[model samples]
Target: MNFETPSVSLNTSPENESHDEQFVNNDTLEFKYKVLSYYNEGKSINQCAKYFNIDRRIISRWKKVESQIFQTKIKRKRCAVKSIIDRSHFPILETQLYSWINEKRHQGICLSIILIKLQAINMFNTIYKNTPESSLEFKASNGWFGNFCYRKNLVLRRITTSGRDLPKNSVEIIKQFFSENCQYTKHEFFKDWQHG
Candidate 1:
C-alpha cells in the first residue's frame, strides 16, 4: 500500500513561542506504514530512511517492533508516557473524589490543601483496606495532591480575613453607601461635609 506523508509547516510567531516547545511530526503513523511497506519490499533500511527523511535508527527500531506496533488489536491513541495517577489501579478514585469535593463545597466548607491531601490519603487507604500495609502504593504526597488538583481543576484560594466583625446587614450597608455617594468626588465630599 502506498502512503502519502502530510506536509509540515514551520509557522511560528514571537508571541506564540514557548521555552518548552516540542517538535511534533504529524505524519508519524504514515511514516511507520511507509517504512514497513518499504522494508517488506526488500528495500535497504538506509534507502528507506533517506527516502522518508527519517533517521536511520528510528526506521530500524520501527522494523524491530513492527508486529507489536502494527498488528496489535488495540491501537495506541497517545504517545507512551507516565501518568501522575494510575487510573487502571484506582479506577473509581476520580469519580469518588469528585463527588466528595462537590458534597463538601455544597455544604459551604472550603477545603484547604492539607485537608484535601489528608482526605486523599484516607480514600486511598480505604480502597486498599484488604491489601498488606507494605504493598500499599498510594502515598497521597504533596506532588500527587498538586497533580490531582490540576486534573480536577480544583483551585485552593486563601480565605480573606477582616478586622471588624461583619453583621448580616453588611451587604445592605455596602449597597446604601454606594447609592448615597454614587455622584460625589472624594475631594468634593470631604470639602463640603460638616465635621461631626
Candidate 2:
C-alpha cells in the first residue's frame, strides 16, 4: 500500500475536480500506509507535512497509533500540560455582588451589571496595587480608575451573555451600591440606562 503518491501533473486548462475527489477517496488508506513508511524511513515530520498537506501533529499521531497497533513499543510523545493562574480567587467578591444583585432584583439589577461591577473592582485592585506611591500620595489624577471602569464596563457589555431588563428593584440596589462605594450615580456614569 503506497502512500506518497506523486503530485498530480496538470497541463494548463481547468483540472478535473471529480478526478481529485476520486484520487482522495481511493488513496486515503494507501496514503496512510505511505505516510507511515515515510516516518519509518527517517523523514522528518516537517518534510512529510510539506509533502502531504496535513498538519505535522496529525502525522505524529498517526505514527503513534501505527506503532501501538504494530507492537513497535515506540513511546508516544509526551503531551505537555501547562499551568495557568485560576482567576477563581474572588469567591467572596462574587458572593457579595450576587447577594447585592439578588437584594436589588426589584430595582432592575441584571447579570450584565453584576459582571461589570465585579470586573471594575478587579481592575481597580490591579491598578491600585500597581500605581506609584508618589502618585498615590500626591493624589494626581492618572485617570487609571476611570479608564479601568470604562474598559471593564465596555468589555462586560460586549462579551457577556445577552442581558435582560433587570428587575425594577434591582436598579435601585445597583444605584445604591455605586452611590455608597464611589458616590457616582448610575445615570450620571453609565449611558446605557432607561427609566424602568
Most TM-score-accurate candidate: 1
| Every model: Cα RMSD to truth | 16.7, 19.2
lDDT of 2 at 183: 51
For model 2 the TM-score comes to 0.24
Q: Write the per-residue lDDT of candidate 1 for residues 67-128, one digit (tens) a residue.
A: 65575444553343233445534556656887898899999998887787778778877866
Candidate 2: tens digits of C-alpha lDDT, residues 1-196: 8878567656422444553444353224456666778777988999877556567886776766674434433244332222122233333444444455456555864445445455546544554465453133322123533443343232323344656897879989987877775754666556434432
lDDT of 1 at 171: 98
As a TM-score, model 1 comes out at: 0.40
Worst-scoring 10-residue span by lDDT in model 2:
77-86
Clashing pairs in 1: none
Model 1 misses residue 192 by how many Å?
17
For model 1, the run of ten residues with the poorest summed lDDT: 18-27
Using Cα atoms with residue i matched to residue i, what is each candidate's TM-score against the true structure?
Answer: 0.40, 0.24
lDDT agreement with native, every candidate: 0.68, 0.51
